[model samples]
Target: MIVAQAKPIEEILEMIDKYDKILLVGCKGCVAVCAAGGEKEVQFLASAIRTARKTQGREIEIREVTLERQCDPEYVEQIRGFAGDYQAILSIACGVGVQFMAEHYREIPALPGLNTSFMGGALEQGVWSERCQGCGNCVLHLTGGICPITRCSKSLLNGPCGGSSNGKCEVDPEVDCGWQLIIERLKALGEFESRFMEIVPIKDWSTSRDGGPRKIVREDMRQ
Candidate 1:
């Protein structure tokens, strides 16, 4: 999932300082799971904003709403009526959700209320670690399910780099070497030599961020 954290209250306030009418939009997906943006979060943030505005003697209208998702165009369109009435949107979803809202509504400004962190899973409540970089490719199968792209400091697909020392990453003493984890996992699974296998090079990164505005053209879906 796209991991993220809610933006600081002070920064959020500064972003919408000029707007009198603001809509605090949340998502019921990734951000919701992370407790950064959801129905409850939306309500809480709305209350905070209103209270702050009142204390500042500022005239403002704040409303909160949570959608099933902001990434899907269909669900995003549902907010057109609600969002149109507002001068700006404070999306509490991930960065993707904020961009989608901004793109869907050209007239109204969309401000991100959360900072997208990474593709990761929660180890516990309120604790999430990066496990994937979404590099437009997948190589976890060969790496024993541990993603070197995120866990490895150097993102080396083959094996550990010179920076690995005594099974720990040289960059951080607290971090276990990503390749070490991969080797251990592979050994446990009886695929100890998976690391030595030759794999074809990952290609076509032009379809990713390095290229300008990567797009998918599904003829059937195109209207």
Candidate 2:
């Protein structure tokens, strides 16, 4: 899932200070699961903004709405009826959601309320860890299930890199060495001797962000 963190309230206030009325949008998708931009978060933010503006002797009007997903055009279009009534739109979804809202409503400014962190999953309650870079090339079949691209601090393809020590990454002692995890996993699966000896070729940079923003066209999924 895409992980995101809320922006500072001070920064958010500054962004909407000029607007007396604004639409506060939230996503019930990845941001909701992460607790950054959901229905509860939207209500909390609205109350906080109202209190802050009231304390400053100013009045602000805000309409809060939570969409099933801000990334989908269908969900975004649901707000078309009353979106123009607001001076600006504050979206607490991922960066993609903010951009989608902006693109859909060209007249009103669509502002981001959260900083898109990374594509990752929850490690534990209130703790999320990045696990993938979406490189467009998956190597989990070649390596063990562990991802060297994201788990490895240096993104090394084949390495414990001379820096790993005591099964921990030298870059940060707290992190487990990605290659170490892979080797152990392969050993458990009885494929270490065979798979580890097979050297992985240099990855194609064209499949990753180095090439450009990417898109997929699926004729079967098209309407």
Candidate 3:
């Protein structure tokens, strides 16, 4: 899932300080699962903003709303009728959602309330680790399901980099070496010798952000 962290209250206050009326929009999608932006978080933020403004002897109006997904046009359109009433929208969604909101509501100021982190998953309680770089080319079939692109500090395709020792990464003693994990996984699967002998080719990053922003037009999915 897309991981994100909420921006500081001070930063958020500065962004919407000029507006007397603001809309606090939250997403019940990725941000919700990560405890960054959700219905509960929106309410918390709204109350905090109200309190802060009150303490300054300035009155402000804020409307809190949580959408099924701020990234989807259908859900975003649900706020169309009342959105114009606010001077600005504070979107507590991922960067994609904030951008989508800005695009859909060109006249209104769409501000991001969270810092989009990365594509990752929860490793344990309250701990999330990045596992994919979305490099456009997938090599997990040969790498024993470990993503060297993200797991490896240097994003090496085929390497232990002569720095790894005792299965730990040289860059960080606590982190495991990506190549070491891949080799161990392959060995357990009885394909170590065969796969290791086959050299991995240089990655063509054109499929990734190297070229430009990407889009997929699926004829089957689109009506």
Candidate 4:
């Protein structure tokens, strides 16, 4: 899932400062699972913005709404009739969601309310650790289930690096060295040597991001 964190209250205020009426749009998709942008977060932010504006006697008009998702065009269209009523919209979704809103609603000023963190999963009660770099290639077939590209601090495909000591990452003692995890998992499955005999190739990031625009053609499913 895409992970994100809410922007500071001050930054948000600055974004909407010029607008007399603003719409605070929350997403119930990635942000909801991460506890950053949901209905509750929307209300909290709405109140905070109102309170901050009231302190300066600005009397800003702010409205709040939460959608099932902001990244989808259909979900964004649900707010079309209501969007014209506000001067600006602050989307509390991932970067994709913010862009989706902008693409769909070109008439209004759409601003992002959260900083998209990464592709990660909940580590524990609150911590979220990035697990995928979306390198366009998946190597989970080898080295057990661990991903050295994302888990290792140095993204070493062949190793725990010289800095790793006692299965711990040398960069951060708190983190479990990814290579170590892979080795252990491979050992358990009795395919330790079979999986990692060949050195992994350097990653080709071209297919990942900014290489070019992405497109998928389904020849068999033509209408």
Candidate 3 at 193: error in angstroms?
A: 1.2
Ranking, TM-score, top scorer first = 2, 3, 4, 1
Tens-digit lDDT track of model 3 for 130-175: 8888888888998899998888888888667989999999999999
- Candidate 1: misplaced stretches above 4 Å? 197-204, 217-223
Best by lDDT: 2
Model 1 Cα lDDT, one tens digit per residue, 92-165:
99988999999999999999999999889999977988887667667788878988778989877777888888
Shift of residue 19 alpha carbon in model 3, Å: 1.3
Report the number of the highest-TM-score candidate. 2
For model 2, residues 1-223, the per-residue Cα lDDT tens digits are 9999999999999999999999999999999999999999999999999999999999999999999999999999999999999999999999999999999999999999999999999989999999989999998986778899998988888667899899999988898999999999999998898888777788898989998999899999999
**Where does candidate 1 have its weakest 10-residue lDDT segment?**
194-203
After superposition on all C-alphas, the RMSD of every candidate to the true structure, in Å, is: 2.3, 1.0, 1.3, 1.7
* lDDT of model 3 at position 118: 95
Looking at candidate 3, what is the lDDT of residue 50?
Answer: 94
CA lDDT of every candidate: 0.87, 0.95, 0.92, 0.88
Once model 2 is optimally superposed onto the true structure by TM-score, how far is the C-alpha of residue 80 displaced, in angstroms?
A: 0.4
lDDT of 4 by residue, 183-215 (tens): 999999998988777777777877777577666
Clashes of 1: 0
The TM-score that candidate 1 achieves is: 0.89
